[model samples]
Target: MSIRPADSTSNPPPGSTSEATSEATSEATSEATSEATSEATSEATSEVSSEVSSEVSSEVSSEVSSEVSSEVSSEVSSEVSSNPTPNLDIREWIRIGTLEEIDKNGPMVVKGIVVFQHEGSLYAVENRCPHMGFPLHLGSVCDGVLTCHWHHARFDVCSGGTLDPWADDVPAHAIAVQNGIVYANPRPKQPKNLDWHLHRLREGLEQNLSLIIAKSVVALVNAGVAPARIAEVGIDFGTSERSAGWGPGLTILAANLNVIAKLDTYGQILALVQGLVHVARDSAGRPKRHMLQPLPATEFGTPRLQEWYRRSVEVRDIDGAERVLLTVLGGDASDADVADMMIVAVTDHFYLDGGHTLDFHNKAFEALAAIRPELRPQVLSSLIPGLGNPTRSEELQNWQTPVDLVSPLFAAFRELENQLGRISPATLASGTSDSPTDRNASSIDGSASSIEGSASIMPSQTSPLLTDRQTRTDAEKIVDVLLGDDPGVIVETLTALLTSGVDPVHLSGLVALAAAKRIVHFHTQNDFGDWIAVLHTFTNAHAVHERLKQSQNPLATRAIYHVAMRIYRDRFLNIPSAALPKSDAADRAGYSTDLRQLLALTDKQQQVAEAATWVAHYIDTGQPMGPLWNTLGHLLLREDAEFHSFQMLEAAIKEHEDWEKSTRSIAKDAMRTLVLAATRYLAAHAPTARELPQVARIAWRLARGEKLFAE
Candidate 1:
């Protein structure tokens, strides 16, 4: 039988000739036709010459036809023998003729696959390299190993295992041969889905493998997992894995959920991967804890639900508490309803772990609000771990002691909460609506040096000239006075300065600085957390100063003085003051160098003292304090500072602005005190040293008199 041409539209059957064989058949057919015509013409002439010629012609025609047919069959068979199993499927066995046909072609691509003949066996695999999708048909096979020519990624053709880790394993087909033909199933052995990917994600987190975490995140996201859900896994894993309760990693993870939503698919995956890495690293080798599981849904009114949630959290039944909250969330609860419930729960326990618990809960709701409503469930659910983690102050300390202050503090918090809407802005600040002209007109211009004019606010004495040396000496003396047993001495010294035409603003700073120093140096048995209040009071004075700058308000200054006195009263915790470092008068450039070097020092406590001494010297030498304030601003922004640190930094920045606008000695002194307080606070907090280069650049600019925050 004559071989037919291979059809391009349909898969070629086993043992079919190639396109080259078909072309050869066509040429042989044309030659055969010409030979038959010539023989017919010669036979007709012989027929006229003799009677036997007719029979001879008939025989010649039969012989010629047989010869042409045989030659065509032989050529077609030869070509067919060169290639075997041109189109083969693993699902069925293929008959591709004899082994000689496979040997002739060595290796051939069949149905977009490469089929190899090795040592009397046939193997088939995907033609594309797994590394970069390069075709494996161009690759060489030797000793059963297939090597991609492009990148030399070698794979065992028999097993489809990659030799290089960078190149993934090539997908091998299930091959079967019957009657010398080969077939293959192109489908992969095992198919992966969303569940599999999520499982891998958990595994990755458990093992702290970054690569697996990254792959799992991308896979889950591509498979349609919500970003919030991905974040939930990280939060849950982080909180549950660590024995020391929740840490900054979980907080950072939740905070970035809003940010992750705005990024592209890859960027989102990357951000989540980074967050997961942090959580895993932070929790690695830590003791594991049982995570709180959400309870069954229930129908309850908002008020009843809030009460139940608060009681559950108060009793430390966090699982039950979270279940109630989640149940409410599952229903028609509004964001406000949720926030109110959370706020009640958080506020139920005052000063929970230095107030970080409350701050985290507030931030959690804020972060939740930033996301779309649909994405809030998983994100909200993730917060259960943190909610259950706080160690309340009441649990740790005896509330019966006078110094415990827990009951009174909680009572104060409740009172403040109750009075929130009842107080008006005018009642709060006394003169918030004062116009620019009113404010500028009220600005003191050294015209009120006499004590009688401002007697109620300032003492009846001529304020001492706050020269650089005198200011330092007074600050040292104030610290000395504060360290003494008598609180009256501290108040009297501060009042005398206020009466000395010393701006109360400056006096506030000096008092705040002393309060800060007391806290820093106080090496007492009682680790009084009340120092936070003292620091906040000192920081708030800057606000009082700013308000009174635009419009004269003696009440603001008096309020600040009372707060300062409270700080003094608290200073008797028996903590001795840290010795203040003596300063050498350095020029502006030299001072800048000192500040920059101080920031780079690993000893943060010493850095604080150095920063304070440098700023004091700058003030004493009559150099502009704005650059020093600007330098601090740059330092504060260097890292992702804690919330409280930012609060102090922002207050300092505002104080700096107020000082820049006014050349009053009080502004200068207050500025100096605020700077010292800030440096000390920062020293305690010790912001991450990741921004040292930026700090250096900022210091250089400030030294040259260039504006830092010009806009």
Candidate 2:
């Protein structure tokens, strides 16, 4: 992923890819990019910079300073936008004969360097324009400024600084005349520091320039900057700049960061870049958020703040919620307390924002963990606006009629709390509390108050289900019941687990395992959109798992019931559940374990079952997992995967790892479920226009001096 440094200042060469391939590389766009730009293809290619000399030859080795101007990544955008090149010549000083060999107003390219004589002075620069890889020789130089006719971006002759704010500074080379011999550096002077690259990364994000972003990503990562640091910048921008607050971009960023280490070098870079690109789009044209201050010191402790925060969220009061969150964060309340506050409120409404509320909350906290803990206030406050108005699932017809899941679940919560002897903060009655503490914990948790007088809905099977496990462990038995057809039994089984003093985290993990199974068992025979249904349940379970581990707050544990109810609603998707593909001796013959074949399965169409089949084969044969992880990463990184896909892959990986470490007998089966879940989800979204990964590939190849543009 690192780029080499060059001595002379010259334009870049195309990568080794074919002209047809590189031409399409310039057109990379995903479903996400198309919505962000009028012409995604054109917009992505418009910021190419010429820095090809860095990879001039394998022999000319100096191992360019890791500090070699971080902007050297432009070579990628510039080269790939054109045709691919096969041959490259490297030299410290490329001689251009004597003065007589140069024309008075000549625009001549020697070894990718453009030597020019302007105003009776000798100068040299890249043969192509720093913006879009257009031939610099085609445009006329006047008044000591280089202008690319394509975009009208103006650059200085000496310093290569941009005359226009929109265009980045061009790479300037060192030109000299000695002993009647004219010589120029093939490589342009690159920006010398990570800060410069970071600044450019911001610029790329600000203008939504894919070329700049592509280049900056290659440079910063190649320069050895930690992925978290880069993600922190995007995370900070995405949260603060978008008035809408915590959106898909940041979520994708957090999710990708969770599994980035499992990817190949190129995949790692692409994963991060994809996240940043989404962040840029999410915040594009949006005004920066005006942050609210925390309330002044008051008599309220963490419990009261928790109540007030939930109450504010319950009323859809953004300002009040933000103030309350900031107030709690500004006090001695730990991160756990902050998480409990958000989770209780999120669960207070069934599947708030279609489960995104909990997912975003989880991501925000995960994003916070990746950065400084001091960012807690800024990070947690962003969750307010999304909570202002979310689609409460309880009001939906399906959740209400066939099975009054809300009332029964609420009733179970009341009875469960009675046994546990703790008050919950989930409100059942549509009545708003006059004050934060006005309602008892039972009301806040939807436990004390009956849901339309439908109290007492505990599982009739709790007694027998716990004892007759078919030789399954307690965790396995609970998971089996969770994925079963009985909604009432599911609730009762969960209640029994919690009351039996089973660790709440273990229960939450089982719920997540059950949710993952829904995806594993999902049949393509069902509607395509149902994928999101299963995805929502798992992501919510993921958030619940994390929060439960953080704090076993009575209110936090309520989310488990909420997540289980969602799993029940998703039961229909598993009808005629897709069978796992098994590997027999014949199946292990040829290409069954091939990573390329697994990826190829995604290239054609929604190979949902086929992908799961491939993953199951890979795992069953005891093939190396590193390559499997790498291949799974390619499935997402290569497509125009939107928010949920990113969320699913990361969560699935985490869940799989969680199961692999468990002492349960079915842990192996659970791992296969998660792997298949992730693989199938990725397969469904695979083979998009593929414009997104093309950009990353081109950038990567160009940085490595692989051919990209024509000679």
Candidate 3:
């Protein structure tokens, strides 16, 4: 039988690890019954054969990826690790002549298995190297270990377990001899090892082993484990292992979780793997947290606890803040109280860490919500350190020099108390946050000062969708002023609205809409790195909007001030703002959309405008929103997107609903615009190395009993 390599063309060869998502075969197979054309494991091989991935051609089952990077260790290991009784029937077995004939030939390939004489016994294993799909038949067996010459990956001849973590285990087939006839079983019984898989997932996370994580996720998913449970393990490990608190990796994981239900199984697997691997990367090499405990004997009331928490964060006292947070949990601090306290701590600062502090706080809660409420303290405290030394925009030159945003913001915040009569937990979600400080240095002007004075940035908001200046409600005008160039007017509009008993939550959401407009209008012509600045502002604005819903904390309104100021600052990015995709671009809108056109656009880089336009056209026509989002979900999974891309997508989805629920004049078509924003951001970052999604596909196939090694 001709055996195909991993991820082969309509034929074999597969992917790369160190490999979050680089295996890029464009084919899918319903039944991969082909052989490796040239690519072998090592010189003897390649990764998964194109046959496997091209074989994937028949089943996008995942459309999950052309980035198939998983080692097909799942099936191979299932064979070696399981102990199912061999079938008694001989009809299904392949007879390889006699044992005497095997000894005379030294080793022989029969039906993709290499029958070999090792020591005094006969062992049969897959002929392809589980590492790269090279023929193991070409390898050398010594001291009972079969070593592939290509990568020097060694495996036990009898059990087929790999000696190297980088390489997956080679499958060991069951063999028996009757009347000197040696026969091998082609089908290996896959036992449902749910607990074992969970344990391995932890091992994968602990060791930061990508392939292990890949295999284990595929196995657990095959066992029908809830994705939330898998995410919980990663969250538990990620939060506890890293001392700095919830970082980008964990945030990305949570962000993806917000929309995991929107993805297909393939997309879901890819989304989960991307999130988990990021968590692993973040926790890797970082010292595990020392873990602060709640105060042992405190009779602290909610007021005192809130004050103590805020003071600790204020003094940059991480330890004190953690203890206070823990104390609240130890006592009867309701979830809302706990959330408000954290929100107050972060919001009091001017866009702390350029909004990361707020975003992280929100996402941590979202991560908690995704799993269980019981893991609250453990997840909540993970956000404390982030509040410690965040970059307070008030102290930054950008907020001071050309634009003195701080003094005015604090002044506007004076009426925050009068607006909120009741207290609530800071509502939340997650996002990326940074000023031009995070932009790459090579841009013509990727500097803090560059974003400071762009008068043109505010004018793009003149439209009703962006800012209904002529609209009736204070909420509507607040939206208009936020999109204006005058910082003083923006502050005055927000303050007067609050003083007039306007819901701070409703007002905060308007700022978020203005922030979203900044993104929807974000011009791709600016320094490529400048996208982060606008994204940070929007996500930060969105985080503030979410928290205000669950919280009546007046201090939380500062985030609103901070993001409004950030929106003012990011105006320059929209100097030549991207044009809104015309509603008339398509004949009529529908509930159905063809993903091929959209997917093809992502094949090349810098398709930001094209992608957003295409999505807008299809969506503007009558295409259903569900399938568009679903396809976008798959498209995102197929690429090696950065943390910010995930942030943009999730935040847009969450914010779109907020807009859709509104009966106000400003809310019209806001949902469509948010989708356009999401489309633009994703298009801006598409076509990365793409190694992670491939790994997801490989694991998925392995779990389904496809021998990628031989396919």
Candidate 4:
């Protein structure tokens, strides 16, 4: 029997399993079948020899004498002569050959199995070998065994059993031959194992690809504009100390994309968390830095991003322990924000109540050790205070914050230090205090002397950088840290400065002004409050400069008032409502009495006036109330003298509003502005003040244009 190889044009070689072979063949079977049929038809119509026919002439003549016999023989002969034809639909079973007629080593692609008479019997079995799915037709048949052409997987000819230990049995086909014709039943079920393997393979591929894509999205965000802009800002401010100097921070982020993308896996995730912590540690620990790259993508500078930033800076609601822990356990948090973000990403594992949560905390602690060893103890202290309830404790401890993790935080802090250092007394002078003796002894143009003289004449021009005569006389206390002598004061001042978004340039200049005046050493204690207040003062100076330049009306007015309110809050030690409240009426009354006395100071009185001025500006001109109302509101409700002044203000605005409608509206606006400033001031410093029935009544009357309280 002539057999042809499974059409290479249609099917690839069988893979490790029959299923793979079938799938490949199915893809190309249509074209191969067409080619085979065409070849067979052409062969049938082509040349044939007459010599063999003559040898059987008598038999042929006899058969032809019977018309049916003649027709059947002719048809059979024609089919047999076809080049590549394997007749598939003949009803007559005619004995042709034995099973050994076709090779067993190779896969039986075509005409591979046969039926033949042996000892007056006929049997049939598939000619293809089972192992490796190879063609049995390509190998030699021996005795009752069939071996594949490729890997020699042997099988029995009769029972289709495998002789080789590793070989599988070939299937048997129902075969019979009659009237010089052969027939076969070729249907068989494929092996079950092959199907299962294919299914698993497909599933694995899909899962892996999905994971890859998810990771890529995260990496892309990290490598985009946010990081780039931060890097550029860092370089500009001389804070970027990353290797290779200046370019774009995104480039570094992009370089890590591969690592970031693989973070879905536990090992990869751990590596990423560790890597980020390491980078943050390096950034924070280093005292000096090299230039870094510019930001990528212009769109990152969207107004929405700026808006988000502005809003975030104003939010001071984070609880004390969390804040303290973040600082103590997380090492200042200025440079390691991104590292914190990385840790947050792995929190899902912990949140699910899986064992992975412990692992997550372990890794987190490890990171803390590597990057911010100093903060570990503090953070632990803060966390321990509230860890009694497991759920709440875990929620608190889990790193899941979604802050921008921008480089600006670290850069800003660095700039703060740099600005402070640049204008530090060590750089510009020898003494700490801006004393008259020190000023006279210095050759630096006596700018300090001039500033002091101006300050004496107009407390507003206490700032050495005043340009306007009106402002010089009316200039609010730009910074009053030097007015006292406390390091704690400096800390508070610095903290306030941070809140106001004080920029480096203005800070440097302000420091210079202070240094020129030799004012720093004038104080006795360098405490938290003093630093924080000084910071507020510096920030107010910057705010004033910005608002005046923009002059965007209501918005600028609002900004300026906020600065003024900060100044006011620091000027008087107005207790914040957030502080521990008094236990009873007696304690509350006692505290109130003492606070009243504190407000009676002359300096505090001046601060109240300054706050009033800002509120007056806003209400009369329909300008931004800013921080004025809020700042003065607390003072008014907290201080007896200041509270009395509100009644006077009410009368003045009422009398002023007795004019025409427009004039009355203007007057009302001015009064409202003043009230608003006071309200805002109270809100910040003494929220409970507004809760007072009397204070609320006054606020309600002012808001509603009623004059129940003198106005």
- All models: lDDT? 0.49, 0.70, 0.68, 0.29
Tens-digit lDDT track for model 4 on 172-203? 54443211222233322122132222232222
For each candidate in turn, give its C-alpha RMSD to the true structure in angstroms: 20.7, 12.7, 13.5, 32.1
Q: At residue 229, what lDDT does model 3 achieve?
A: 92
Error of 4 at 615 (Å): 64
Q: Given candidate 3, what's the lDDT at residue 573?
A: 90
Predicted structure 3: lDDT: 0.68
Better of 2 and 3 by lDDT: 2
Which order, best to worst by lDDT?
2, 3, 1, 4
lDDT of 1 by residue, 1-711 (tens): 122111212232222233322222222234532432233334332332242245643543343233212232222222223232234221222222333455676666654456777654566676767554567877888887899987899998876778874455665654432222343433322223456556766777787766556655655665567888787677656655676445656555554464453345544554566557667777888778653444555556766776677667656676787678777877776766776556545544433554455445533454454455654555555556666657554334332222322222322222332334332332222122422111222332112231223222222332232333365335555545544544334444544454445665555555545554554553324453544655555444433443334323232344343344445445654355554434473343256545565456424533555566666676676765555554554455444354455446545555555556765555555456556666666665555654422332332332222333432
How many backbone overlaps does candidate 3 show? Answer: 69
TM-score of each: 0.40, 0.81, 0.77, 0.18
For lDDT, the strongest prediction is: 2
lDDT of 3 by residue, 1-711 (tens): 212112122111112221111111211121221222122234222322332334433432221121121333344344334554532233344455565677678788865677787665667777777565667888999998899987899998877888986676776765544334454545432222466567778878888887778877766665567889989989998888888878999998898888888777777778788889999988889888878877888766977887778767777889999998889888887878888888877765678897888888888887877776667877888887786678867667777657666555544443343355332223211111221121211221322234455222222223332244344265555666788777767766666566656687787777778888888898878998998998999898888888888885666676777888899888899898788876455324331247787888888898877787688778766677777777888778888788888888889888887777888666766777788888888888888888888877766665554556555
lDDT of prediction 1: 0.49
On TM-score, the leading prediction is 2
Ranking by TM-score: 2, 3, 1, 4
Among all windows of 10 consecutive residues in model 1, the one with the lowest summed lDDT is: 1-10
